[model samples]
Target: MKLPTDIQILEKIYKAHKNDFEQYENDNSIRDNKIFVRVDLLKIAQELKVDKDIVFGRLYYHLNHKFNYQNAGNSHVKLFINRGDYGKDEKGHEINFPYMTSILAGMQYERRKYQMATIIAIISLAVSTISVTISVFL
Candidate 1:
């Protein structure tokens, strides 16, 4: 099995939750023409299985051109796993850079992901595994 790269994982997650990113841009875009999506760095860090700083650095480094803002990427997109983290970090640092204001601004602007089917499938898989384990052991 081949492991997915950090960028690949990010792109996959971004595509899944693209609507949320678009919504963020729609609600928070400073200009009508320019679109700067507000991404959850903490989430990306969790999905990448690495430090959030690494993901942030990678995105910033790649998208350095015309990207003079904060806490946003204008070039590449990535996955976010920290469902709990939206606008603030553990230390309560201001997550929003310029337009993404408020503590829950990130989550507030974005729409919820439709993962009910996946969750149900996972539950079914777990139940089958548990049944097999019980039959084998007992």
Candidate 2:
């Protein structure tokens, strides 16, 4: 039998724990702070009749690369699954671009700062070498 796709596996897990997942999502105490639904991975695995490792590997890969979902904590134990479009606008477009943009901008700023520091270090070295040579000649 063919293995299920990552999305299919996730769907199965959601279906198996529909009530828990929905309750978790609807609970302001949980959803107000975090955009994740905590679920027991071992239970989901047993319900789907799949190995826990396979489920974890697929979930991790999809979360990081495809942005279909985000997960926290260990899949072998429990996991918090957050939808990619959790905070999207009504039209399904991301409404929080400023937050993500600020993050990218911060990363770029750090990169530029490092580049400038390296340039300054090289120039300082060059000046120090020149001064040493002049002292030797004097």
Q: Pick the candidate with the highest TM-score.
A: 2
TM-score of each: 0.35, 0.39
Tell me the tens digit of each residue's lDDT in model 1 across 92-118. 212112232221234433423336666
lDDT of 1 at 96: 19
After superposing candidate 2 on the true structure, give the runs of residues whose Cα lies further than 4 Å from its correct spot.
Answer: 24-34, 68-138
Worst 10 residues of 1 by lDDT: 91-100
Pairs that collide, model 1? 10-78, 10-79, 43-80, 43-81
How many backbone collisions does model 2 have?
0
